[model samples]
Target chain A: MANMAEAVNVEALGAKQRRRFPHINWLALAMIMPSVIALLLIGLYPLLFAVSLSFQRFLLNRPQNNGMFVGFENYAAVLNDPLFWSSLGRTMTMLVIVLIVQIVAGIGIALLIDSSRWRVLNWTVKTALVIPIAMTPAVVGLLGVLIFNRDFGLMNYLLGLVGIEKINWLGDPTMAMVAIIITDIWQWTPFAALIMLSSLAIVPHEMVEAARLDTKSPWMIFRHVKLPYLMPGITAFMIIRTADVLKLFDMPFTLTRGGPGVSTELISLYVQRMGFRIFDMGVASAQAVLLLILCIVLARAYIHFFYRTPEAE
Target chain B: MAQAQNLQTNLLAQQARAIARRRSRIPASAWLQLVLLLLLLLFILTPFYWMVSTSLKEQNDTFAIPPKILFTPTLEHYNFVLFSPSAIVPTGLQNSLIVATFTTLLALLLGTPAAYILARFEFRGKRDLWFWFISNRFISPIVVALPFFLIARDLRMLNTPQALILIYLTFNIPLVVWLCLDQFRAIPRDLDEQAKVDGCNLFQSFWRINLPLAIPGVVVSAILCFIFSWNELLFALILNRSTGQTAPVQAANFMTGFGVKWGEMMATGTLIVLPVVLFAAIVSRHLARGLTMGAIK
Candidate 1:
């Protein structure tokens, strides 16, 4: 084994490798120096500084003399607060709901598209679904706002045609969360579908044919074959979307302002309200660190079950 | 001889069964396709139709006893929003454009080269560096807003275009670098090595050779960055005043007025939403790998 490793050893070529690839082009490094520096100072340092700020009171008015050590007190405070707990609870449940809807829609749509041998319907529906992806969450939220606007919104207009009473979408607490969820489905179902469709399109034809030969139903084929194959993409996307949906801000903020009495206040929105709106940096940073931990933990679990590790983790 | 005939009959029976099974499922398959097609149409068209229909309604007609789909459409709302004495509609559009242009230009200017180096060079902590940048996503925008609030305050950059440019970079740079990074990396290193040997300086090689190769990705990234910055409200709201608010923030503000300016806000919403949706649909449709500059996952 050692001898085999030595034979294929990459670093063994060392000096010879440098000579062969001999173009470090220090000038590229020279031009890159400022940008690299700027990224470090601007992009990187803020993250580190923010983490530290979590431990200290970096309040706006008290900027000069506010470096008192408060060890986990902020985390403790956030934990004890019902507002944080509830928002987090809401965010998680919402994540599960949105995720289930998106994934099912994604897998189902992909399956439909994949099975249809006809060129016309297959191409048209797939093309149309991709349109939702182009719409930003902000625009989607605005669209939702227009639709849900109680007095003169499009949704009310539609309901009027049906003889239904106008419902308060952004105003009522129950309706506010529903409004956000609908907006997300509008924008992101396409994303989930597009990614899943790519993976589904490549499932081995022979395996599917063999399954069919064995008298498997389409549902069974999906449950047994396509599902297992699509797991990795689904897992990776879930990791991304979970981290994202947890930070749901733009849409909710725009549509509801976390209002109708905090019904739609997600965690990131909660943190922003604490940090920026209230200028309570210590608590806000603490809130941020806790969120980071939650995200990392969730991500680790996702990586474990679904993502093949770089180190096979 | 009898056993061989039996085996041949069984094989033919299996083939027939397979064909029969397929034939039986054909109607069901067609029915399934029809149902899915209807769902797809409803899913895509409902909101779009609703948007145009709402935009067409009279301001008072919108809140009618029942919703009016067939009411006579009027240009009154559009006229009110666009030409109203009170609305800063033009300023909002201009602010969005200026901020978006500045942010996109700067991100491309700085990000493309850095993206190139990170993509090509095998540097130390490359992954960590990449994560360090993309991890900006992980940091809630609220966190960014807080520090920048101080930074902005300290420099008195509040409400200034430069502040938006700076704070916007907190998120936008990583986005640009990540997107451009993949494109830059896809270009073979041999191209750069050849440019170096041809007496091009590092900047010259990067600008003259590598850049042209990375143009498609850069333009796509520029579109994404512009759309994001244009639509960005958290920072735009914090850093700029009403006079300087980006289109989305401005539109959002219009909704906060007494009883909400439904018509005006929708008009502004339509303006901002249309371009971005089209751009994403047409330009940034590459289902390729993310534009990460080699470091971040």
Candidate 2:
């Protein structure tokens, strides 16, 4: 076994040597330098700055006492603040609910589209899905504003057409959250659907056919065959969506402005309010750091749980 | 025995014909799927429809009690949004175009070569470097927004289109790198070796050989980069408030000032979304991979 391992290592080393060309390493480093430098200046610098700012007492409103090292005071304050906790709770609620709704609806829609026999309808639905996914979130929010208008809005009008009373969609707190969720679902469900559709496309035709030959039900086939193929893509979508929802800002910012008295205030909005609106950079940075940690942890956890090597499988 | 064999074959043929007939006819479940998908399509397209329709409606007609389903559509709002002197959108659109174009160009210039090296070369710390590039995508914009604002302010670059163009690279370059790395990987390494034998340098081989073959993927990346830069709001909102606002920021601005100008806002919204949706449709086939950062593909 030791001799075999040594032979493999020698062979790998020989392969590496053969792959190398004269002056390649320098060229590679030179080629990659500009991007690395750019990222370092813009991306890494700000990240480090935010970390440093989190440790300091920096307030844009009070420049006189700026940059004073405050240890964990900002972090402690952020943890103690009811607004922080509430906004975090709101964010988690949105994340969980949005994930569940989008995943289910997306998979359902994808399955329907996949199973449909009409090529035109399939093409049309797939084409239509791009609009929402491509729409600018700010515009989506603006559309929400117009659609959810109390008196002249299309939503209320349509609701009234069904003989329902006009509901103050954005005015009431619960309804405001509901409105945000609906707009989000409307915009993002397509994304989820598209991902699932692609995943469904990879479900082996032969496998399904064989399953059918075995007299398996469609549900059984999907549960046994299609689902395993969908899991990785779904998990990836979950990670991407989780990162997005944690930083959910643009749509809700324009839709409710964290309004109806902060009912719709997500964590990103909270940080924006603290950092930009209230100009409390220290606490905001602390919160940003915490949110960053949460995102990394969740992403790592998801990968750990769902990500498996093909060999392992 | 011959009669029995014939009868069995006849029964099998009858079953095949029955199955074919069933397959040819649309099932109830299929019809149900059609209805559900049509409704889903409607749900997806309604906002777009509303935005365009509202953009065309007159100011008074915009808030009509029944919501003007059949009004004479007017271009007055579009006229005001596009041609009027007080319009914020055209400049916003221009700034958006300039910033997105430059950001794409710069990101391509800086990222494509790096992506090539990352794809083809086996170097020390390659894994770390690749992860570093990708991990940039995971950082929230808010975390960087404040520091960027401060840095821009310190450099006296605030409210300049250059500020946005430069800052957008922080994300766009990573995106370009991530997407183009996959593109470069998909190309055969034998092409590079052939170019080398023909006396082409490393850069020439990349520029001439791999890049042409990877052009489709590069264009996809470019389109995605342009769309992202075009649609971004938070950085544009913070970094470029008045003079350098993008179209999305301009659309959002309409919400903040005075009574909500639904007609004008929708007009702006329509304008902002039109190019993105069009571009998205053009590249819709690759969007699943792009959105997932090439994980699915």
Clashes of 1: 5
Model 1 superposed RMSD (Cα): 8.5
| Candidate 1 segments whose C-alpha is farther than 4 A from its true place | A1-25, A58-73, A117-124, A149-168, A295-313, B1-28, B64-66, B287-297
Q: Report the lDDT tens digits of candidate 2 across residue range A96-156.
A: 9999999999888888999988799899999889889889998888889888988888899
The TM-scores of chain A alone, one per candidate, are 0.82, 0.89
DockQ of each model vs. true complex: 0.27, 0.51
**Clashing residue pairs found in predicted model 1:** A160-B67, B130-B296, B178-B291, B178-B292, B179-B291
Compared with the true structure, what per-residue lDDT tens digits does model 2 show for residues B24-138? 7878888888788788878888879999999998889987887667999998889988999987789999999999999999999999999998888766667667767766766
